[model samples]
Target: MIEIRNLTKSYGRKNALDGLTLSLGHGVTGLLGPNGAGKTTLLRCLATTLAYDSGRVEAFGLDPSQASQRTALRRRLGYLPQDPGSYPHFTAFDLVDYVAILKELTGREHRHREVRRVLAEVDLTDQARTKVRKLSGGMRQRLALAQALLGDPELLILDEPTVGLDPEQRMRFRALVSRLGESRTVILSTHQTEDVAALCERVVAMDRGRVVFDGTPGGLAATAAGQVWLSDKPPARSQLFWRTADGRYRTLGDRPPGAEPAEPGVEDGYLLLEVAA
Candidate 1:
């Protein structure tokens, strides 16, 4: 479990996280926000990889601001940054093994077994002997994920974990994350609204570095309930309108004449919140 209170982080004059407060427990929670909304800043603060200007962050009853507690928290934490850089020359097995060592998995035999287990978990067992430079973008992403899965971390912080993954790989990731959420805390930050709808029990939407909406996926969808409409033509004044596969324009805003009310989805609610913010 983790708790953040009045957290604020700044870069020069702009605040990345502005008086943000949140609490996270078991299961998967989807973090949704636009550019500059502070999702990465918040995750970095929680992962103990970045310091904040002000506020309190307590994870597993440990204060990350303190050196000793930060070290202790790192032992139980798994972090997949937005851009998890890769070593071009290291083999998949070697890369994961190297991370396992950093996590203090000292014994060679045990660490190697862990490395293999995580590699298989990410469905990269066949490519274990291949060099990172030879792997595709998706495989490299999976390799990053494999390293995060090492040590069976208690808290997993994943920022765009499905970035380069194809549909099938994304589905596999969903399954794995869904299974992981059964017992541990996983904070998944992503732009994919469908992923949130499919894998998250809780959805938190952010805007201008503050939480604009925090509730269940259904609850988020419900926020746009009566505002979504399907019409043959775009609404006159609607700012959020898009063509759906059904050959109708799905519009969000005031009702348009003869437009049928369509069921609102997570993406609809998220966009509505963005417009409101």
Candidate 2:
């Protein structure tokens, strides 16, 4: 549903996206990267909000540069940017209702059904009348997600969606996303490896504005297959181990002669990429 070819973006002399080329088909795909990894830049381009200096980007076969085609693409695209905020005077219901109108500009009363359904879908029906300022952080995030789904969009691009959410809320949001992925393309950008492992059918790892890895969850796990391990004590080379709260450690590289195999996880694979970069 998303395609980027030789896309390049520059902020003065610094390059944010450098000749990046990748194609995304239908399903949930995680755009994984560290801070300033061009994940946002790429998403903005795909969202048709930010223009790139060079190269071509197409979303569902519609070129972003074409004004006539852009609106059609927008009709099918849903985006939940990080830190999406609501106006102080707008209630949760009001905010969602507004988005519903934009999704179907002339529907008026017909849009009300969409607005109500989305509010309940995100479990905000109880707080529908409350002003945005009164809702808790998690509620606002849910509201943002509700609006993203307001259009029954075929392609959803969410950036760092789970940030600031509590564990329970995060799980619920993940479940919602998983449900959406069953029929459409859901592209999410996040640095949290576990988030990708949880919901995405494929993971795309980027660093320094370039894609370094793009594959299935199992393929990602294989990156650190033999590199993750556990030890009775912290290894002398402590850089490889991630310290745990229970006085245990998860280390990378060949285990010491007597050390047994430790459980490999998303973070282990993540670290392998970090180390490689």
Candidate 3:
């Protein structure tokens, strides 16, 4: 549903997205990256909210750079930005209502119905009248998601949708996002490997504005299959090592002396990749 080719973007001299080429289809796809990996820049460019320096972006068979096409594309998509602004004075319902209007839902009754349905989908129905300032971080995140679900768009782009959410809330968010991706394309951008492992069938890892890896979650983990090990103490030769909850050291890289092989996870593969870069 989306095609990008050699997409390049920059902020002054530093490149945020450089020679990034990606294509996405139906179902959920996770975009994984570190702080400067350009995941957000890619999302903003794809959402038609930010212009790129060069290359092509086609969404739903239209070039987003063109005014008419971008508007048309936006109509068929929903976007939940990383920092979705909140109106302190507006209640949850009011905030979603405002977004519905922006989406061009003219009929009052129909718009209200859609808003209610979306709020329920995100489990924010109980907070419908709660002011934005009064809602907890998790509740506010759900409210942002509610607005994104207003039109039941075919393409959903969520940037860090689980941020500020507790474990229970994150689980709820995953369930809602997974359900939404059943028959549509969902591009989820986040730093959470567990979120991607749980919700995405395909995953892409990015670094320094470029695509580092793209494949199934299993494929990602496979990159570190023989490299992950566990030891009683931290591995001195390991590229990355951390003390586990059980007091053992889980290490990735060249296996250390007395270390036992451990099954690699998505995060393991990702860290190994970043370390290599």
Which candidate leads in TM-score? 1
The TM-score, computed over Cα atoms with residue i paired to residue i, of candidate 1 is 0.99
> Could you give candidate 2's per-residue lDDT for residues 1-277 as a string of tens digits?
6788999999988899999999988889998878888999998888888889999988777987999899889899899988796786899988888877777745777687788888887889999999999888888888998988877899999998887789888888889899999999999998778888899999999988899998987788888887877666878754777667777677888675456686677777877897888
lDDT of 3 at 3: 95
Candidates ranked by TM-score: 1, 3, 2
Stretches off by above 4 angstroms in model 3 are none
Residue 86 CA error for candidate 2 (Å)?
A: 1.5
Candidate 3 lDDT over residue span 17-121, tens digit each: 999999999999999988989999999998889999999999779999999999999999899999999899999999999999999998999999999999998
lDDT digits (tens) for residues 1-277 of candidate 1: 7999999999999999999999999999999999999999999999999999999999999999999999999999999999998899999999999889999999999999999999999999999999999999999999999999999999999999999999999999999999999999999899999999999999999887899999999999999999999999878887789888978899998998889999999999999998889
> How much is 80 displaced in model 2, in angstroms?
0.5
Q: List the residue pairs that clash in candidate 1.
A: none
* CA deviation > 4 Å runs, candidate 1: none
| Residue pairs that clash (backbone atoms under 3 angstroms), model 2 | none
Per-candidate clashes, comma-separated: 0, 0, 0
The 10-residue segment of model 3 with minimum total lDDT is: 233-242
lDDT of each: 0.95, 0.85, 0.92
